[model samples]
Each structure stands twice: as structure tokens, then as C-alpha cells.
Target: MAKTKEAAMRTKNLRGIVRLSALAGLAVGGLALAQEAPDRGIVHVGGDLYRAHNNAHNTVFLVTSEGIIVSDPINRDFAEWLQGELASMYDVPVRVVAYSHHHWDHASGGEVFADTAEVIGHETMPGALALPSGDTPLSDAAAALDANGNGQIEQSEASGNLAGQFALIDADGNGMLTGAEIARGPVSDVYPPSTVYSDTRTVTLGGKSVELIHVAAAHSPDMTVLRFPDEDAAFFVDIISLKRLPFMDFPGLEDVDSLIGTIQAVEAIDFSIGVGGHGDIGTKQDVADHRGYIEALRDAVAAGIADGQSLEELQASITMDEYSDWGSFNWLPNNIAGMYRILGGGN
Candidate 1:
């Protein structure tokens, strides 16, 4: 009886282990399916132009006549989705991709479109990418978790694989980066652009004129805004987004007032519509809203300085609740800090 009882217990334990294994397998399969699902939030803007909000940090623009032009491709998954969407709209291939700045959220995904499309950026963009200050935490974690363990992080990782995606910078010089390192780098993937412009450049595709305008540093030193004059549509990449806070961690914060002025300069130009790097395409009001947010933050920081408040105090006191609903809130705190630094306080 004792032997029979012991055998029965062992059999029951084996069954339990098998059941657990099956459950684990099912869970993993479900996750894989979720990852492989089709892209959501792809929308049409009028006449051959499509805008896709891949998530919070990337926005892609597709022009059927002239192929596709992306403001900032955040990751490989997003890049793939963008390409697929363009293909669905136009039989022709994507011709060009323009980087808003050298930041990873705007540039890392270039590998996806880089192979086929002409990846373009400002004259200083290549140098910025080579520097080690534009990495992000979410990117680092994803890189660590990739199947092959390469340092390249993808969008899927930023969305689900990781708990939160935070902008990070790399202070250390090691080629292998930590999440912190990625957040600190100025730009990643510094490939030579097919075309580099100092002030402005124009490319005509399918009889449509696409103008790449270099707006003086508001978010980053090499910020570029793309305009489709005939379409009356403009893409203000990184300068603004829908619900998230704009990132102001670049070197241009010293001239916050000038940055706002530069944005106003763009506003003076007549354009019926504008698209941000991370949000929906809308009227010039979108541009004005972004400017307002920046101007408000600058004023708040300046007020804090007048009050003799420390950097930490200023950061805590300034609130972006009015603009919180705008995309990129994850990056707002950093923007505040950047402003504080520009105002002569360091933390």
C-alpha cells in the first residue's frame, strides 16, 4: 500500500508540471501573436498623404505621388508599419526619410527605411549621431532583451516588453550602452544622408514640391521641418507632438526665447496644415499651441529664477498640466530641467 501511494503522488506531481509547462507555452504564443498584429492608428490626411502615429515618439508621413517621407521613425517595427502602409497606398517604393533631429526617438528606426529610402538630415546630424548622448532607457532594455541581444532596440520593446520608455543619454564611452547611455547620446545610427542641407533644400516628387526647412534650434540644434507647399501641409517634427511634452534636452535651451521666435518664424509662413513628429496633423493652431507651451515653460523657469529658487524647486513648481494632454509628456520633465539649465541653474 505504501509503494502504491508513493507512485500515485509522483504521477500527480508530473501531471502538474506538464500543465504548468503548457500554460507557459500558451502565454508566450499569445504574446507573439500580439506583437505580430497589424498596425493600428494609420490615418489619411487628404490626397495621397497619410499620417501614422506609431506610438508616442514617432510619426510617419506617406505621400502617394512621391513615395513616403517620415518625420521621425522611432523603431524598426514602426518603420516596417510605415513601409507597409505606404505600399498599401502607392505601388512605388519609399524615396526619402527626413530626420527631425539626431535624437534616437527620431533616428534609430532609420535602419528600417535606410536600406531603400534616402535617409536625410541636417548638415550637423551625422556628427550628432556619432556622439554618445542620444540613447533612451526603453531602448537599452529592449536591446538587452532582443533575441540576438544586439544593442539595437525596437518599437515593440518600447511599448510592451518594457514597463516604461524614458529618454536617456550615454555619458560613458563604451560602445555597449546601458539604458542610461542611450538616453544621453545626441544621435544614433549616423549614416551619411543622401542629401544634407545647411539652410534649406527642396525635392520634387511626382510633381509635388517638398521643402525641407531648417528651423533654428528649438528642440535640437539640427531640427528640420518639412513642408509640402502645394499641399499646404507642413511637418514640424519634434518641435511639437499631440499629447506628449516636447523634449528640450538639446544644447539650444540657452536661447529659449529665440527658439520660440524661430517657431514663430515658421508660423509666419502660410501653410494650411501642419503635422508634428508625434501627433495628428492639424492647422497652424497646432504650431501656436506648441509655441505657447514652450513660452510658458520659459516664463515659469524665468520666474523661478527671479524668485531665487533652486533648480529642483523650479522643476517642482513649474506645471505643464495645460499642455499635458499633448503627446510626449514622458519628456516634459527633462524639458523643464533643460530650461532650468538654460536659465543658469544646474541640478
Candidate 2:
């Protein structure tokens, strides 16, 4: 009963009016929102390894005799909350903040820790986090966004998620957004890493270590997978979910082949347990099953296209009942359509 009520508060916390509309059109939903998950909690994954929760999002941290190594602070509110818990429960401060990727949801609140922690990420993170200078010309898409041709995006000119974030991103409170402000991406408070690495780099803190492996462009170009050998666990985000269907119906997946291969890569890593940015914990076998689901969906969609079936027929025909017991299985239709478009079939 206690757990149930706390979860209700977490759900309520995530249902802000501004957040609801900004994420309304987002693709990562099979249900209403992550608000349905939980408010927050800390779970023990292994010796000295803990998983932090914020509604549907999760991050990991390792506590050692020296200090703590944390990954993906998640967001400002969650980070602040987690920091308070750390201060109360443990004597050590967070010595390192490791990013899984540059996506705002997982990385936004990192600034809270960066004042003291050595934040680190793949070499590409700087590029992902960089805001354009005033003189920087807008991409065709961004330029077109300047509907009034005033070289800036006004509140009225913005729509969708951009409209929702307009007031917040409009620095100087001028009710106007320059190309630089427009480049701030969807979320804010994403502090750039104090340390960046081009290839694999081992972060040793307080006698514990986490190896950041720069992975291929599966989800985000700057994605990193943190391997905690001492803890015998791995932590990742978005690239794969443990035992859950793809988020946002696997939105923007043009290279299904590459993503499946990336899952295979994850399976080969040395870890008994795996924690993702969302959903349940996983293992290598679970990773393999994840690969299987994508492979099955892709093959089904490709075969249907070859057979001249319409997108509706493909969606109707491919139920993926093998994974019917999986979480978010209701999103199978959206997943099917996503593959259909990827295979050069559906609109």
C-alpha cells in the first residue's frame, strides 16, 4: 500500500501541463506517459551498485570506499533528489557523472553534479551539446522555421514541441529565439562533459572503474555503454530496453539492420545483469531476445513488402505473439508500421 501511493505521486509529478503537451506528439509511448511507472526509488542491482529511478527513467551509480560514480543524472529534479539521498545515506560525494547519451531526459539534470564531479562522455557529445553561434546559418529546416523571415523564431511561429519549450529556451526573456537558442535542442540544463574521449576510456574513481565504450550510431550518435566489471553489470539507455518493446514505436529507425547488430554487440559484452534507461533489468539472454524481436519484426515487415501486402495487412498479420507477454506489447502495430516505412514500403 505504501509503494502504491508513492508511485501515484511519481505519476502525478510527471503530468505537468507543459510536459504533457510537449511530449504529446513524441513517439516513445505505448501507454500514456512514464508518469504511469513510479515517482522515484533506489534499487540494489549488485554489490555497491544501485539503480536510481524517476518515473519510467532509470540511472545507475556505484558506491566505493572513496566516492561514488553515477551515470545519467536523468534530470535536474531527479538529480537534486538523488543527491540529497546520497548525502543522507552515504558519506561519499559523487566523483564522476558518466553520461549514457546526450538526450535531455537522461542527461539534463547532470549540471547538479558537475560542480564537483568529473562529467564524461564520448568525443561526439560536445558536438551534440553545442549550440550554434549567432552568425551560424540555420539548416534548411531551421531556416524554414523562421516563418516571418526575421532571422528568429517567435512564439507564434513555433509549434509542436518547439512551441512548448519556446518560453523556456528564449534566453534574455525577449520572447524571441535566435538560431543559437533554437539549437538548444528539446531539453535544457544539459551540461557538456568536462572530459571527453574518442574511444574506450576507463573511469576509475574510489577504487572502482567503469569502461565507457563508444558505440555505433544506433540511437544517438554520442551514445556510450558503461561497463562496470567489478559490479558485473552494464548500464545503457534508449538503444535497448530490457524486456520491453521499443520506446516511441522505435521512432526514427531508418537503419533497422544496424540497430539489430548493435543489440548483438550488447549481448557480447561482459555483464551478468544489464540496466537500461527504462523498464526492467535484463541479462545477455534478455538482450538476445530483444534482438530476436527486432529481427522478427523487420523480417515480417520486409517479407510483407515483398509479397505486395499493404501496410494494414502487414500490421494485421504480424502479431509478434512470441513477445505477447512482453511489456508494451500493444505497440506492436506501431512497431510494424515503423518497419514498413523503414523497408521502403509504407508512407
Candidate 3:
């Protein structure tokens, strides 16, 4: 009887423990459900300028009396989200949608604003948009984004490898990859700029003026800096990250000379705060720091080249260990190679 009672007691304890564990699991699940997704909130940077940050990408807008002028919608969902957010907060329509550069990450989803807003970009933007992202053909990209092998590209299949190649196949930003979209062909996330400018275009609206300056080919051939003189703030996308080291040679840094010049020019401007395409708001010091990093890398590469260091030698020997604490330390070798190619013998 004693043994039987002991076994029953152990069983009771086990049941109680199981019950507690189940309750704990439920509690954990509830907490998880309650926890919200990362809020890509619109940060008001004083005056009419506001920043709509989604994921790592940023789109800045100016609340004008006529309507809103936004830059770099990022993607379709983000564009829709921004539209909705604007609708909720303000009664104005989006008047102008501007492309910071021709890069897809910043240039996509402008079609959403096409009907209402005038899409603007640098003159070189159209040619850049027409070019292929890589060597991959349109048909191959379409096949890759076909995901289900259903011979039809549906939105459901927009995951995995398809997501990356979708921009290459989805000619129309209609969320569907149909033969119609494919027939349009030469797929790209970049929409044709309705308004183009060479150097500077000053936009005056709602008692505010936005000075659009074609800074340099720092990030792309047609990188435009949006300067709000009244607010003393400028949005310099892709070229300068406030805190981070930047993504892999700073993503198509073709002209380091132009970059340096652009930085100096921006520093000369009376702006106090700046917004980069892919990071937090930048102080004047952040801009200077970024310029310093670029200068140092250039100097390092120049020194290596002067020492007759080959690509391999430079890759192995050169190091930016001083920037070890920076965002993309792993990209140092790549940065070194890019600098070598640009500054050294490589074309």
C-alpha cells in the first residue's frame, strides 16, 4: 500500500509539473503575440521635413500646403504604407516623388505615386534604369521568380530567391508577374523620371523651397541631394551612413574623387543635421567622420599602389583595423579592392 501511495504521489507531481509547463508555454505565446513588429515610424525632423523609415531604407517627405513631396519609397508595400500614413495624418496628396539615385532599393515603387505626383530624377537616371542589374537575362530572372514552378509568377511565390530576382522580372509594379509584364520586358524597379534636371532645380511650394543638387557620382551617376535651406537639413542618400561603416565598398562607389568633393561641398553648406539613405540621422560630425574614413581608405590604397602591391598583395596586406568597431568590418577587404581598382592601376 505504501509503495502504491508513493507512485501515485509521484504521478500527481508529474501531472502538476506538466500543467505548469503548459501554462508557461501559453503565457510565452501570449507575450509573443502581444509584441508588435518593428515600427517603421515617421520621424519628424522639424519644419515640414519628415522621415518615413522602413526597415533599413528611408524616404523623406515635406508637408507642403499643396501636397507632400517624398523621396525614395523603397518598395510597393512601403509606398502604400506611406500613402496610408499620410492619409491618416494629413489631408494632402503626394505631389512629388523623387529618386535619390537610380538604385532599385531607393527607386522602386514610384508607380504608386505616378498618377498624382511628378516623378523626378537626374538626367543620367533613365540610362541607369535601362541597364540590367547584373548579367542575368530577363527570361532567366522571370523563371527564377516563378517560385512554384507553376509556369506563372504569383505573389505567393515572392519569397526566397524569387524576392531578389522579382525586380528583374516584374516590369510593372502591379504585384503580378504576368506575360504582359514580361512582354514589357527589360524589367527594372526604376520608373522613368517625368522631370529631369542636370545640375540644380529649386522647387518652391507651400511657402518652402527644396534645392535639388546633383552632388556627384559618389553613390551613383545621378545622385541628387535634397537640401531644405529653410530647415537647414539635407537628405544625402547612399553616399553617407551616419553611424555604420556602409555596405560593401559603400555600394557602387565609382568615383571616390567626386565623393570627397561632394562631402566637402556638403560640409560647406550651412546644414546642421542630415539624413542618409540607410541609417539614422547624421550630425555634421557624422558627415565629416564618413569623409575621413573614405579619405583614409583612399590614402591606404594609394600607399599600397605606390609600394607596387598587386591586388592580392593589397587584399592580404591592407587593413582598416582602426575601423574595426564600425558597422561593416567584413567589407574592409572588398573596400580595399574597390579602392585599389579605382585608385590603383585597375580601370
Candidate 3 local lDDT, residue 103: 70
At residue 105, give the lDDT of candidate 1: 62
Give the best candidate by lDDT: 2
Which scores higher on lDDT, 1 or 3? 3
- Number of backbone-clashing residue pairs for each candidate, in the order shown: 29, 5, 0
**Candidate 3, residues 293-335: lDDT per residue as tens digits?**
8899888888878887787888888777777777667878888
Q: Arrange candidates by TM-score, highest first: which order?
A: 2, 3, 1
| Worst 10 contiguous positions by lDDT, candidate 1 | 161-170
Stretch of 10 with least lDDT, candidate 3: 1-10
TM-scores, all candidates, are 0.65, 0.84, 0.71
lDDT of each: 0.63, 0.79, 0.73
Higher-ranked by TM-score: 1 or 3: 3
* Model 2 misplaced regions, further than 4 Å: 1-38, 133-149, 167-174
Q: Per-residue CA lDDT of candidate 1, range 155-180, in tens?
A: 23333313222122222222234554
Candidates 1 and 2 compared: the better one by lDDT is 2
> For candidate 1, what is the lDDT?
0.63
